[model samples]
Target: MSLSIYSIDLAKHSFSIHGEDTNGNTLIHKTISRAKVLTFFANLPPAIVGMEACGSSHYWARELTKLGHTAKIMASKYVAPFRTGAKNDLNDAVAICVAVTRPSTRFVKIKSAEQQSILMLHRARDNWVHERTALLNQIRAVMAEFGIIAPKGRHALQANIGHVLEDAENQLPDLARAILADCYDHLLSINQRIADQERCFDMLVNHSNNAQKIMKVAGVGPITATVVIASIGKGEQFDKGRDFAAWLELVPTQYSTGGKPRLGRITKKGDKYLRTLLVHGARAAITNIGNKTDRLSLWCKGLVERRGLKRAIVALAAKNARIIWSLLRNDTEYQVAV
Candidate 1:
């Protein structure tokens, strides 16, 4: 039988496949070992293949595409409602198959190996940054125990750490002093690593033309710009700037009945890391908006005055997401509104 579509529940050692023919008759249903997956698909006629967008799904999608079959990677949440029976790999595969057939189901864009590689740097840098923050907090706690206090900022801590450790009047025990010194050294090491990673990111941004274009937008820097470029590539998957902004979950959530709409907070539905970076960039831009006399800055200042700072930041972030979408979609440079 010629199958219309096949949905695969991907796993490490095996995969569950569910298939139906053009007349809506069940034709293939079973689990196959990982080594034989390609062989099984190869024997069948070219058809649409569906899988939940999870680990290894993108890689498998790429491989399936190479075999002359259409590959669709869907968000698991969208497929869950289609499950008919008890939760299991087979049932999940069936659900995926059902979901993929729906005309309105959204599929994840398959990321290339290059995109994944660039993202690795971001993940590494984020991990080290968290470690640095933890170490700083630990240092502050330990210093407070000795009746020595570090000030608010990282630079203040840097200035006071050596003095606290060397002060004889603080009566620091030998063991405690040695531990704190070791922790301080570790903190220094982490800082150096973060700096190195940032340097690498800087070089990457300088080479990427799209990243440079994104950076031109207000509030976006090397980190945010590279992330946008790496995550969306050409942004062709998004139909418009609003679609892209909604994907980032920057748009407001809505609840409506009787044609009366009530909007709430942002959906926050997408990548947490990227969303956070965008918000932080927006905050920075908002803080500086008052100092500038440009049209965009003046408009942002008006928004801040009307909506207050927090909402203003979110609005600007959502606006920037739209601007980013436009730049990527059109491959055009940003020109600040005068």
Candidate 2:
């Protein structure tokens, strides 16, 4: 019998595949080496292929689509409930096969090569930033051990680190001074790399009309705009603005019971990096909202007074996320309320 659906549990070298016919009867279940995967799929008639979203899943999805098969990549959590046996590649593949056919399963957006490249840039920059922060903390701790204290803040550390290194009166040893000097230089290098990434983001924003359109929102800057574009092109996967906000996990978490509704804190799920950028941008907007009488600014002021500063910031971030969805999905600019 001809196979109607195929699910693959992907790995670095071996892949487990499970296939079913149109009548839901199992057709094939086996493992194939990485080299033979494409050749195997190339011979099959176009059918629905499913895989859990993970490393290299998008690349495989693109390849499968090129083979005239409809590929569906789903979050692993959605597929886990379908597994009938112990967790293994074959079982995972079977789970994927079952989950893909479910109507309510939410699938992840397939990122393009360009979008993936931009996200890689962001990841690299984020790594460097974390590394830099760690280095700074190390330097501070080492200096404190020698009874030398640099003032707080990055700028303060930058300003005093040199003097601390040069000062022979402090208890700092020659070895510790040399090590700190090297760390400071590394910090500078990481800073330069981060600046380069920002420049790349700036160029991306200039070239992408979608990024430009979303930047008109109050809480959207170049970083947030470019990230949103790279993460979701035109926001078409979501049916509405609230759906987009919910996907971002900016909405409150629900813990409702029978005939009762209860909402908790923000879910704090999904892409943490993207959520962080949105929240930081929201904080920046709120910090500078003084004396502004626009509708959004007025709303922010009232919200801050009513719900406190932190909740207001999250509310603004959620609102901005929705506005961004509307702007991108409709291919229109944000209209500022005067």
Candidate 3:
């Protein structure tokens, strides 16, 4: 089988492919409908195909592989520099061609159906959680204008609403109390949705071997485990533990001058949602169980004292990403050194 190189630009209704080889020689450039993309590739010899990572790109990549062609998915940002002239399908396709063949460029890993399914779960749960928070904040803010303050948390809302309403000596009028009562009911409804999603997450991570191994670390639990697993897809893409951590944006941002390197704030470069989950889990470990005397735990505990809670959580999250990367890469159990 011989290898041919081509770039593709995917759009809503149509697609374009720009074929070329090294030494700046053009081979084939044509537009095809979405329905015909697979058929067109099917006739071509087994070759290398490059496309930007976007919606449905993964599915197409899988299809291309089935047709015996190798697919390289590059981030759109990386492909932008190779684009010549206006940003249209042809130029974009050319950009992808240049980007994929670049030795220094990074490619996206192919995700299996199971990995995609788990990620769907994460997206659904995250949406529900966000909706819940938005409503909770609105409820609190609305109540504040009426001089009615619910307790600090959702649990406190029910009890606090009752207490404030029952106090005849309070300044809130009947209408304000009635409004607070309705908002509390709405807040409770959102809480129920969150609980339901959490139950779904529990069922998800419970069945996965990787998720179970990851949860063994101090800063990880069921939610964190699933998010990390889903976001990483297959761990084969990462070359090292720090590579995985850096992908999760767990590492400190880098700056160097005069051969002296300095670290600043976290790069926070990867998936924001996954990073947030890891940081949250790290916080839980530090506050509730960071002093277990294990190597990582002790290190995290000391970090909390030295760097304060927020920085400590970010640091531990980075460590946890590295540990996860190691676990997946080496296919070994996590050992807690005391």
Number of clashes in every candidate structure? 0, 0, 0
- Ranked by lDDT from best down, the candidates are 2, 1, 3
The C-alpha TM-scores of every prediction are 0.95, 0.97, 0.89
Which candidate leads the pack in TM-score?
A: 2
User: What is candidate 2's TM-score against the reference?
Assistant: 0.97
C-alpha lDDT score of every prediction, in listed order: 0.89, 0.91, 0.81
Better of 1 and 2 by lDDT: 2
Q: Candidate 3: where are CA atoms >4 Å away?
A: 21-24, 161-185
- Please give the lDDT score for candidate 1: 0.89
Best by lDDT: 2
Please give, for residues 198-314, the per-residue lDDT of candidate 1 as tens digits.
998899998999998889888999999888878989899999999888888888888999999998888757888998999999999988765788888998899888989999898
Residue-pair clashes, model 3: 0
Candidate 1: pairs in clash = none
Q: All candidates: CA RMSD in angstroms?
A: 1.7, 1.5, 2.7
lDDT of 3 by residue, 211-252 (tens): 888888877888888877776754888888888888877887
The worst-scoring run of ten residues by lDDT in candidate 1 lies at 1-10
